[model samples]
Target: MSSAPVETVLVAGATGGTGRAVMRLAQSRVDTLRVLTRSSDAAADLRAAGADEVIVADLLNPEGLSAAVEGVDAVLSAVGTAPTAIPSGPPFVDGAGNRALVAAAADAGVDAFVMESAVGVGPEPSSPLATAFDAFIGPLQEAKAAAEAAIRDAPLRHTILRPGVLTNGSRTDLVTVADPGAKLWGVISRADVARLMLAAPTTPAAHNRTFEVVSKPRFPARNVSIDWTLP
Candidate 1:
């Protein structure tokens, strides 16, 4: 990691849905923002959105990924392929492209790696959503599992957050998840996931852990504080 009060961050696929939120939130906490995108149009948008530098790169190109990640304090991977119209196939992004990002982030000596995963990626599809996920998003889910495993086993501080049904909504910041699997039922705002990605780099407790997240159900939404235990 770079020796500075604040650090630079490299975000791949910065123009995508999840990545955009990561960028929007992370830019406020870091000194330098390095956004990686395939299209120049997105690059301009990233630059205007406060990215210190926008690098045109391809994840498939190891050299490009390595270059993009160099001299960064942390890596927040918001990269994934949305489930296609067709049914699932063999593991997709997780096998190669996702692995490349992990490899590159590790090689670049990143201080921390925060990534997003599905709620039931590993552990034998304990929930019903796992079965449905495997049927519709099998390839990508498998890919995410493999990618997560790669990061977890690496010699870097890693936090893998599995959020339930991503909804594009406001950032409530408050969320909860439990291990027994009952807590997996709910939707989480993408904005909050973005907050977690930015917050994870700064929270030492989030290191070397994988956990699920979901927004709290609201009705009598009072000033009731909730305890969030990050794994």
Candidate 2:
């Protein structure tokens, strides 16, 4: 059996590559597509991108997020931070920003929360490429790890997808989802990840699970099925 798609979905980081894909795909699935943006200048563009409503709020600001998430059925967060040197002040968006969003979503009683995470942040063994990325952006990875932990501890049904080497290619629809520690490394299009993230809330098999996703027919396939059927 399958569940119906949620009525409303709030897409955080709606202007980013993956977030744009989520917003585009969500147009026909959910009843309302709400997009959150840090800049009001993005409002017009987000609306043209098929967002039913654009809520201008920074995920870094916890106090302003309540109204953005209010009454939404699910939240798909593609928020992330660029690599920066270790800081003396507040944490980057990967950690504190996502944590704040989770808090707001929980307080608003959102049903499902899905986040885009890196493959190397969890307990998974790192690939050579992943290793180098970590070395370059170690701080961001650490922050993402913290955010993942916070999502796990929160009182929300969540799906965390750890994708390797994001690309701007088109959606292939042929994808493989495996354990986080499966040690798989490959490039996956942002469109494909967006498809899975949007489907996660309604896909019972995806709830509360963290997995590494890669385009299929690539290296290190675990060759196991986990019921990825979408509603």
Give the TM-score of each candidate.
0.85, 0.92
Question: Candidate 1 at residue 129, lDDT?
Answer: 56
lDDT of 2 by residue, 168-219 (tens): 9999977778877777678899999999999888888788889888884465
lDDT for model 1: 0.71
Alpha carbon lDDT of each predicted model: 0.71, 0.85
Candidate 2 worst ten-residue window by lDDT: 222-231
Candidate 2 lDDT (Cα, 0 to 1): 0.85
Which whole-number lDDT from 0 to 100 does residue 165 have in model 1? 81
lDDT of 1 at 228: 31
Provide backbone clash counts, one per model. 1, 0
Q: What are the runs in model 1 whose C-alpha is more than 4 Å off?
A: 1-6, 85-91, 179-183, 216-231
Query: Which stretches in model 2 have alpha-carbon errors above 4 Å?
Result: 1-5, 84-90, 216-223, 227-231
Report the C-alpha displacement of residue 206, candidate 2, in angstroms.
0.8
